[model samples]
Target: MFGMRKWNTPVLRPTAPFIIGGIAVFYLVAKAQDAMINSEEYKNDPRNPAIASGKKAH
Candidate 1:
């Protein structure tokens, strides 16, 4: 009589969490940048005299 044995394997790599965390961080940064760019405060800042004088260059 011949018998076969099966082996169970476990995941040894710990890269999934790091990849997911990096993606989440990237999304958050992009979202924050978009919000800042679209905000009125950023568009109407006094530091840039051009914007305050209503002479935005295209």
Candidate 2:
């Protein structure tokens, strides 16, 4: 049925791109954390002078 009606289809094109970009950003962050865990920096925990000298009351 060909009925002449003006219907506005809200633009949904940007939704997918936005979601994809967000996922990419979070993925990169996780990858960075993985790299850190593999690095020596993460493996070695630097001693804190303050905590070593005196224990602060919690």
Candidate 3:
């Protein structure tokens, strides 16, 4: 003898979009970081100058 409930359905089966969206976001972030590390733009950025001397501006 088995007892089954008629109202025992899952309420979260519509989360496929959110799960796929999260994976896509993570992939984009990783790709961007890889590009930055391998690109010339990161090496030529002036905000992070290699010179240790501070310049005085008028």
**Which pairs, if any, clash in model 1?**
none
Quick one: RMSD of model 1? 9.4
TM-scores for every candidate against the unseen true structure: 0.52, 0.52, 0.52
Q: Judged by TM-score, which candidate is best?
A: 1
Clash count per candidate? 0, 0, 0
lDDT of each: 0.68, 0.63, 0.62
**Per-residue accuracy of model 3 over 5-39 as CA lDDT, tens digit each:** 77776655688788889999999999987566446
TM-score of 1: 0.52
Local distance difference test, candidate 2 = 0.63
Per-residue lDDT of 1-58 in model 2, one digit per residue for the tens?
A: 4676588655667588988899999999999875665465544444533335564422
Ranking by lDDT: 1, 2, 3
lDDT of 1 by residue, 1-58 (tens): 3465476444435677888899999999999875665567766666655556776633
Q: Which ten residues in a row have the lowest lDDT in candidate 3?
A: 49-58
Candidate number with the higher lDDT (1 or 2): 1
